[model samples]
Target: MKDINLTKEEKADAIEAIKSYFFNEKDEEITDLSASLLLDFILKQIGPLIYNQALKDTHYFMTGQLEDLFSLEKHVQRK
Candidate 1:
């Protein structure tokens, strides 16, 4: 399985981007603190749901289940 490693700066940037995108004022109108709560909900709930596909891909490779599918498409031909 490929290691899921994020550098410190990448992690920090993602956090800040989420905060600004969800919570900051839009078109001069301020949103409520629900922005923060919504971000929290998404990170806790939706994030994992989205990551599940990656988990499946990784699991298959780690367990040798991807051999057939991966081998079906030859890298030499693609190049």
Candidate 2:
């Protein structure tokens, strides 16, 4: 799989969120570099699993819609 790339804004936002989580939940303050490293690790290790699961969910939903469409088809009578 290709590497997951985030926009600069998104990366910055994520890093901030990470910092906030650590501060709020763990009562620890982390540097921007530390949060960035954690974000990179999550993207590298967990991103693909989440992406694949989303694809599977979309496929399943589309298959169900297609079956419903096929069921709506009308048969024509021949002489």
**Among all candidates shown, the one with the greatest lDDT:** 2
| TM-scores of all predicted structures | 0.40, 0.92
For candidate 1, the per-residue lDDT at 7 reads 74
lDDT tens per residue, model 1, 1-79: 3334457676555656655765564533323455445556766777777688878888978779656667788566553
TM-score of model 2 vs. true structure: 0.92
For TM-score, the strongest prediction is 2
Question: What C-alpha lDDT, on a 0 to 100 scale, does residue 70 get in candidate 1?
Answer: 79
Candidate 1 wrong stretches, greater than 4 Å: 1-15, 22-32, 64-79
Clashes of 1: 0
Task: Please list the C-alpha lDDT of all candidates, in the order they appear.
Answer: 0.61, 0.97
Q: Model 2 Cα RMSD, Å?
A: 1.0
Consecutive 10-residue window with the lowest summed lDDT within model 2: 65-74
